[model samples]
Structure formats: C-alpha cells, structure tokens
Target: MPQVQRVPMRAVKNVVLIAHDSRKQDLLDWVKYNRPVLREHRLFATGTTGALVQAQTDLPVTRFKSGPLGGDQQVGAKIAEGELDVLVFFWDPLEPQPHDPDVKALLRIAVLYNIPTACNRATADFLVASSLFHGEYERIVEDHAAKRQAWLAGQGRR
Candidate 1:
C-alpha cells in the first residue's frame, strides 16, 4: 500500500500564475474579476505577466524569469518542493512556445505532485468556488523517497 498523508490546505493558498504572451490580457482580466479571492492568497508569476498583474491589480507577486528564459522550470521546482499549492496557468493552445518541453515538464510535475492546477479561466473559477478552496482537503502524494529505499533494499543495493 502507498503511504498517504492528510495535509491541511489553508484558506489562503500559495498560488502561481502564468500566461503566454497572447493570453496575458485574458489572465489579467480574470485576475481583476477575481481580485477578492486572489488577495487572500500568496501569489507568484513569471516576468512580464507578473509585472503586468502587479501593476494592474496592485497585488504583490513574486516574480520569476520569463517562461522562455526559465520561468516554467522555476514554477516546477516550487511544485516539486511542495511550496506551491495551486497553479493557474493561462497558456495559449494555438501558439507553439519556444519552451514547449519546459511547459510540459511543469504540467507533468504538477500532476505528479498532485497540485491543483487551472489551465483556463473556467477551471480557475471552479477551483476558487469549490468548497475545498478555503478549507483543508486530503490529497494523495506518492512517497517516492520511501519507495526508492524499498526498491534499493529489495535489490540488495542499499
């Protein structure tokens, strides 16, 4: 059986926001509409989007490098480190990104770590409106370290 833990998700979540060049306006507009909810949480974002969001919304956002320049990896590192609770990424599906592999890695890490992610405004809305949004919820996280230890033991390679 896989080990599991019931962690408390605070009423104020740690959220990362990112958007492609084409969807920056869309994300900004959505952020404006959801300011009340957003203000309650810790926010982070990539370079241009972060600056734009902070400028328009007046919400303090921790800024990272631009996505093409390593912002996606930065966010993925946060997820891997268990620092971010949710990811609200407004990626442009029609446009191919220069850092496409990085984008895929970010999404993959989010899922692997069981982080709540919103790829669109609709999903973001539902996420914020859900009963669990402001309350504690249980999520399953794989105990990879332990699993690796067990595998090493079984292989007699400890």
Candidate 2:
C-alpha cells in the first residue's frame, strides 16, 4: 500500500472562490453574508468574478485569468502545490461550460488533495461554521509519487 502524507493547515486558510456566470450573483450574496467570517482568510478568485467580488464585498482577492482563459488550471496548480486550503465553487450544473474539462480537472484535484470543498451556499455555510475550519487541521492524502513509482516498477516487470 502507498503511504499517506499529512499536510498541516494553518488557522487562517487560503480560500479560492469561483462561480459560473449564471451563479455569480448567488456566490456574491453568500460572500456578502459571510463577509465577517470570510474576511479572516486569504481570498482568491478568477478574473471577472474576482473583480465583482472585490467591488461588491470590498474584500481583497488575488485574481487569476478567467476560467476559459485557464484560471481553473491555475487554481488546480495551486491546490497541487498545497497553496490553497479551501474551495468554494458555485458552478452551474444545468449549463454546459466552454471549459468543462478544466472545471472537471479542478474538482478532481480538490478531491485528490482532500481539501475542504463547497459547491453551493448551504455547503459553504456549513464549511465555515465547522469547528475545524477555524483551527489548525491536518489533511491526509495518498503519496502520489510513491504510488506512481510502484506502478512504474510493476510495468517494467511485465
């Protein structure tokens, strides 16, 4: 079995917020309502969403490129590098996105890394309200490199 690794998270988290065009207002409302709790953490978002968030909520957000322009990949990269702690993405399930693959990949990475992810308002609220969200926490994830090495070695024997 591949070994697992524990990544320690600080009390103040690095949170990334994302929303589809149709869901932007919903996300904004949630952010506005939770501004007090959210202000305690570092914020990040994709282009237009970030701008809107900053304007509406008066919160500072590190902006990446727009989703279709590769912002989802940028956020995924940060997750892989252990830079992002939480993900609050309000995606439109009924609407197909131009960058659907990127969105799927981002969600996959978040699950693989075992980070806290919230896909809607209710879940987002619960995530912030959880005791774990306010304190130091340790995330356990599979050691990917070790698993890859084992698979590679087995392939060579075939």
Candidate 3:
C-alpha cells in the first residue's frame, strides 16, 4: 500500500469557483444563496464568471484569465501547488467547450490533490453544510512519488 500524508487545512479555506457560459447563472444563484458562508473564505474565479459573481453578490473574488484563455490551467497549477482548498465548478455537461482538455486537466489535478470539489449545486450545498467545512481538517493523500520510486526499484529487480 502506498504511504499517505496528512495535510492540515485552516478554517478559512481558499475556494475557486468556475462555470461554463451556459451555467454561469446557476453558479451565480448558488453563490448568492451561500454568500454568508462563502464570506468566511477567500474566493477566486475565472474572468467573466468572476466579474459576474462580484457584481451580483458583491463578494471580492480574485480573477484569473478566461478559461479558454488559460484560466483552467491556472487553477490546475494552483491545485498542484497546494494553494487552493476547494473547487466549485458548475460546468454545462451538455455543451462542448473549446477548452475541454483544460477543464479535464483541472478536474484531474483537483482529484490528485484530494481537494473537496463540487460539480453542481447539490454537491456544493452539501459541501458547505458539512461540519468539516467550518473547522480545521486534515486531508490524507497518497505519497505518489514514493509509490513510483518503489515501483521503479521493483522493476530493477525483475
């Protein structure tokens, strides 16, 4: 079994919000409804979405480039660097995006880093309602480098 490490998370989480063009309104609604809970955390979003979120909810959000212009990659990099704590991406599954690959990579990195991610309103609501969201918590993640090294050593013996 791979070894695991526990990463401590502070009560004030760094959360990134994302939404496709078709789903921006839905995400806005969710954000507005949860403004109070979100006010306790740092918020981030892509260009248009961030503008809309800020304008609508009056919440301060750090804005990145538009997703097609590399915003998703920026978010993915942050996740890999352990800077982001949560992800709320309300993407339109039925629509095709020019930056689909970037979106996939973003989701992949989120899973790799073991961040709490929500793809829809229901999941977002559940995440916010969870007891862990309001307090300090430890995230357990496998030590991938060690596992790779072990596998490489075993290969040399074969």
Candidate 4:
C-alpha cells in the first residue's frame, strides 16, 4: 500500500484544460460560463482548444501540442513534475481516440499524483465553486516510491 503525505496548495492554481474534438465546444461553453472563476487561475490547454478559449474568453491560455500529437503526454509530464494543480478534461466517451493509451496514461498519472480532476461539466462546477478554489487546500498525495522499490527488489532488479 502507498503512504499518504499531506501537501499544501497555493491560493492561485495551475489548471490544465483538455477536450476531444467533438467536446471542444462543450468545454468552451462551460469555460465561458465559469470565466469569472477561471480567469483568476493560470490556464493551460491543448492546441486549438487553447486558441479558442483565448479568443472567446479573452483570457490568456498556455497552449501545448494537440492531444493526438502528444499533448496528453505533455500534461502527464507536468503532473509527474508536480506542476499542475487541477485537470479539467472534457473527453468524448462515445468517440474513439487514436491516442487512447496516452489518454489513459494521463488519467493514471493524475490519479497517481493526487491532482484534482474534473471529467465533466457538473464536476467542473463543483471544483470551481468549492471554497478551496480560492483559498489554500491540502491534498493527500499517495507515495508509491517504496512500493515500486519493493516490487523491483522482488524482481531481482534492485
């Protein structure tokens, strides 16, 4: 079992936003509606979504490569690096993605890192409206280093 560590969150959050091609509009609508709350935080997004969000909301958005071209991996790396505070992904459940494995890996990394994530609009609303949104919050981080080392020792690789 992994151990838990309490970590403090900053008042201003670093948020990652992503969406499938078909769900981009939905994300846009949601963001626009939540702009008052979202605008206060640092925003990151995959290519076209970033551009559209910036254009429509007039809010600054940091852009990564398109998801199919490794944007998901970029976000995952940031999560591993402990740079992101939240993930708002509006993925299309009905549509198949060419980089499905990457998407799964991204979600897994988020879970492993104990980042706050919202998969749909309702959850997104809750995240944004929570008192922790504008104040300091503590998160329980799952520490898996000892588990990995143990497994490696059992495999005769440590």
The candidate that wins on lDDT is: 2
Instruction: Output the better candidate (1/3) by lDDT.
Output: 3
List TM-score per model, in order.
0.91, 0.96, 0.96, 0.93
Worst 10 residues of 4 by lDDT: 1-10
* Span of ten consecutive residues with least summed lDDT in model 1: 2-11
Regions more than 4 Å wrong, model 4: 154-157
Worst ten in a row by lDDT for model 2: 149-158
Model 2 spans > 4 angstroms off: none
What C-alpha RMSD separates each model from the true structure? 1.7, 1.3, 1.5, 1.5
Cα deviation of 51, candidate 1, in Å: 0.4
The models' CA-based lDDT, in order, is 0.91, 0.96, 0.94, 0.92
Worst 10-residue lDDT window, candidate 3? 149-158
Q: What's the lDDT of the predicted structure labeled candidate 1? A: 0.91
Residue pairs with clashing backbones, model 4: none
- Candidate 1, 33: how far from true, in Å? 0.6
Residue 106 shift from truth in candidate 1, angstroms: 0.5
The candidate with the higher lDDT, 3 or 4, is 3
For model 2, residues 7-63, the per-residue Cα lDDT tens digits are 999999999999999999999999999999999999999999999999999999999
| Candidate that beats the other on TM-score, 1 or 3, i.e. the better one | 3
Residues 22-114 of candidate 1: C-alpha lDDT, one tens digit per residue = 999999999999999889899999999999999999999999999999999999998888788999999999999999999999999999899
